[model samples]
Target: MLGDSAYKLALETKRTQAHLPMYNEALVHHLCRETRHIMGELETLLQSLETIRDEPDADTRSVAAQLAVKHATVKRNKRCLLAYQAQRLRFLQNVFWQVGGVPEEIKPQLSPAELDFFSGYALAVNTYKAPFIDLDLTVSDLPPKDLYIEVRVLQDCGEVQLENGSLLLSKNSQHHVKRTDVDHLVSRGLLQHIDG
Candidate 1:
């Protein structure tokens, strides 16, 4: 079953068709088919790795080295396939993507502040393709702590506060953000370093 956020996103996507390439539906269809194939291949590679891991009779050391190399190769290929799919989505939908979802194959540039903001804010976001202008506008103020918790179930923790207000959670906390996500959020002026 879809989560509430996913269900809402599905509805919004149906209403707006922001991610579909209707102009070239045929092309997008083909791309989607190919993307599914690539994903299946990636899954197979992962399963192969698991098989090698479970092969008690096989040379575990050689299998470990092979699995690492296979994993990297799978990652690189999956990235390329994803980029292609994203480009195809852009072409089909003719809708603008968020600054962060511009397909890394296009450019990897993101400012430091945006990095911080995206990093911090990513912890609270659901889908990147949602109508973000409204929600994105609220980054400066941010959702209340409990509300953020409601929206993000799998997101990393961005801001944390201790039970006491003396020391910052960042000081004693191990919570961290990815550099890209940090750039994505901070550039938009969404994250503020606050005293806890």
Candidate 2:
């Protein structure tokens, strides 16, 4: 029997040896070799049997037979392209999913007019721009208790009224800004019209 310390050291050596980078590298090399072997078999089957096509030849028939065999062999693999498609869709859905549910991905390019239209809205939300006034800005996470609710959104060309029920935005505290005033503000390039 070895001494306890020596046995303990030996066990630790074995454990350490198993986890070495060299061991992992070897495993990676082994996997690469296996994959190459499998691909080689597939390549053999897929290689054109008819190096030159002519009127019906034995070579063409041989190639078709080889392909049929390979197809059967490939069926035994862990599914195929459709399986990959399913996995890909799942990944994209996971990334874009939010509490309000799925939103469409924005396209890479928008028309210049659309771009111009959106620039103000983007500036409003992202930065405190002119006419991007937060009339009812609050810290309280409460919905409007009053019967009416109004929100201002900027649009291209001019700003518009976004309201529902009774109340409009508290114009300088007491009343709502008049519809004409809102449109004028929008027309003057001071504000983009809000859409409902």
For residues 93-196, what per-residue lDDT tens digits would candidate 2 score against the true structure? Answer: 33222111222332232234333434544445345434556442212234424432222433332223444333333233223344433443333333443333
Which segments of candidate 1 are over 4 A away from where they belong?
Answer: 1-22, 56-196
In the range 75-151, model 1's lDDT, one tens digit per residue, is 54445445544444443222122343333432233334333444455443445526564344323233344312211
lDDT of 1: 0.40
lDDT of 1 at 190: 44
lDDT of 1 at 18: 34
Clashes of each: 22, 7
Which candidate achieves the best lDDT against the true structure?
1
Alpha-carbon deviation at 89 in model 1, angstroms = 11
Candidate 2 matches the true fold with a TM-score of: 0.23
Model 1 is weakest, by summed lDDT over 10 consecutive residues, at 146-155
